[model samples]
Target: MPELPEVETTRRGIEPHVTGAKVREVIVKRHDLRQPISPTLSTIEGRKILSVARRSKYLLFGIDDGSSVMIHLGMSGSLRVIAPGEAWKKHDHVGITLSNGKQLRFHDPRRFGLALHFTLPPEEHPLLKGLGPEPLEETFGVKYLRSACSTRKAAIKLVIMDAKVVVGVGNIYASESLFRAGILPQTAANTLTLPRLKRLTSAIKEVLADSIEQGGTTLRDFLKSDGEPGYFRQKLFVYERKGEPCLKCGTPIRHAVMGQRSTYWCPKCQR
Candidate 1:
């Protein structure tokens, strides 16, 4: 699935082309996404897209009529901008033709993505309501993390991965952040002190910022809106490097399954 950085990268890449451009048409090749394409989705046609923003892992396309379109690139989904009559690929499920003469295509092989139109403010939408602060926002600082982790008995990795505690700390980034903070993934969340939590928070912010700067981690299903792979994967310290020598210490990286996600860490470097 595309995480925060990946979604943010898409938002940045497409904003310049889509914002201020009127929607010429809305095409739904299929209505069965993770969330059914809203029957009212066609209402967006002829409306200008005022802005494009990302919240957590969802992209928000702000329309002139106070309505918004929210999209989620699920396990195996991507968005591409191409010519109006370009040949559609097998899984191209949705397309929005713009007055700029370009079409935005959504491709999802697993059909697990979302394309929903909501008249309400995006924060009030069921999918977005109750989501925790964005990991890179000021609202998600050390103090907020400390409070969220105060009562949890779950492993530190699991606690941070909780969308209720902080958004966009997905499996890969969580592992990378913990490794950078010198914290073990299995450490109890509530057992950590304030100073340690502070370091962990900083590491999380740093890791996410670095990934976004690099255009996000190049996972199997993620790609920039321009169809280029992100280069952050080459900079990973511990993620997916099980049994490999640690970059900091000579110890071999260790791997385990926690919260049903593969986790990697350096036994000697990460306490």
Candidate 2:
């Protein structure tokens, strides 16, 4: 699935073309995705897009009438902007035609993406209401992470990846951040010291910011709105480097299954 950086990249790539443009039409090629395409989405026609933003892995399109459109690019999904007459490819599930003669198209071969309209304050929507603070925000600091970890007996990696603890730390990022902090993935969350927690928090922020700067890590189906694959995967430290020499210590990188997700770490470097 696309993580925060991938979603943010898509938001940035499409914002220049979509923001402030009037919607000429809203097209839904399929009503079934991870969730049903909301019928309210039809109201997007004739509305002006005010802004494009991201929350966690979801894209938010603020409209002129105070409502918003929320989209989630589930596994194997992507969004692109094409000319008005561009031929539709397979799995192009949704399209928003702009008055400027461009179309914002959504494609998800797995049919796990979502398109929904929010008439209420978007922040109050069911999907957004209880999400944790954005990991890149100043509010998600060492102190906050320490507090969140103190109450969880789960593995440190799983705790950090919990959306309720801090949003957007997916499996790939959790492994990379833990490796960067020299913390083993299976360490008990509540057992981490304050100093170690500080290191982990900083690593999380640094890794996430760097990934966003590099346009996100593309292990599989993620793509920027312009249809470019992210280059950050080339810079990975431990995730998916199983059996390869650790970049820091030359010890073979190890792999394990945690919470049903593949985890990679340096057995020697990451205690």
For model 1, the local distance difference test gives: 0.92
lDDT of each: 0.92, 0.91
Indicate the TM-score of model 2: 0.98
Q: What is the lDDT of residue 222 in candidate 1?
A: 83
TM-score of 1: 0.98
Residue-level error in angstroms, candidate 2, position 158: 0.3
lDDT of 1 at 169: 97
The residue-by-residue lDDT of candidate 1 on 226-260, one tens digit each, is 99998889999999998999999879999999988
lDDT of 2 at 189: 95
